[model samples]
Target: MGKKLWYHSSCLLLFCILCTNSFAQVKPADFKYVDHILGYWRMPTKHSTFTELWVKKDDHTWEGKTHRITGRDSVEMDNMQLVRSGNELVFTIAAVADPKSGKPVPFKVTVLQSNGFVAENPACDYPQKIVYKWKKEDELDVHFKGVKEKTFSEIILEYKRK
Candidate 1:
């Protein structure tokens, strides 16, 4: 019974791994609008505010940096990037401050619709899916969804163009 259970558990784990990596795909051309994601976005409050900047680097990539300010202090948040990779575009997160030195974990952009695009990194713990949606009418809507402690977790951040 013990051996049978162990074998079943191993198979289940392998299946999970395969499924996670086999998401959908999108064309590189569909990602062209990501350039509009550049410029600064901010959410303001009375005491503090959060701001993010996406700076373009050539035609294929944009460097991202975020700031959270409370009173007199401003804190730097995650540094990220969006880049074109072959037939698709990818989003990568920096593991440290010095981007050149840090190894980036890449999330493949799989779905690009009229509204926006979706990217996923199967191996990541906090954000398995990262989605960015924009319409000419207004703000950028971003969603981060993943699993946590055997449960699904999601966070949404809306940013207005500045």
Candidate 2:
């Protein structure tokens, strides 16, 4: 009985720490200036490259396009929308692989950072989490990871401003 109680107590403590440190909500002042995410970013690998374009549409809306580049051609791989509603940021993505992308799914931002944010769809089939990290003014790192096929995996992409 003592061993089980200890284990449960430890798990609860860890959960509290993770919840406090990993998630953030945008305040009015912070969401007021998300234009930093607007622009172009490219990630190049030996085999292929990924590119993203973010455009500000207004005070509360943005559009993003992601492409896969090999050789010289760029193929659109994902279309996304970033919207700020009140104090929350919403992400809607249309991925080429999702047949139901005709009606995109909305993922709300759960972790808001100084320069980037993470949005998630816990109901998704594969990559349920998406994270964008700004390493520098000209560098962005993106992570796509979650439980897929009952296995946890992550894909990291490093991007530089173009």
Q: Give the alpha-carbon lDDT of every model.
A: 0.79, 0.82
List runs of model 1 lying over 4 Å from the truth: 1-23, 45-47, 95-102
Candidate number with greatest lDDT: 2
Q: Write the per-residue lDDT of candidate 2 for residues 71-150, one digit (tens) a residue.
A: 98879998888898887888877761455545776777877767788888788776788888888999988888899899
Tens digits of per-residue lDDT for model 1, 1-162: 999999999999999887765646566567767776788888786777888899998777889988889989999977889888677788886642234555776888888776777888877766788888885635887888899788999888788887
RMSD of 1: 6.2
RMSD of 2: 4.5
Q: How does candidate 2 fare on TM-score?
A: 0.77
The stretch of ten residues in a row with the least summed lDDT in candidate 1 is: 93-102
Model 2: CA > 4 A from native: 1-24, 96-101
Native-vs-model 2 lDDT? 0.82
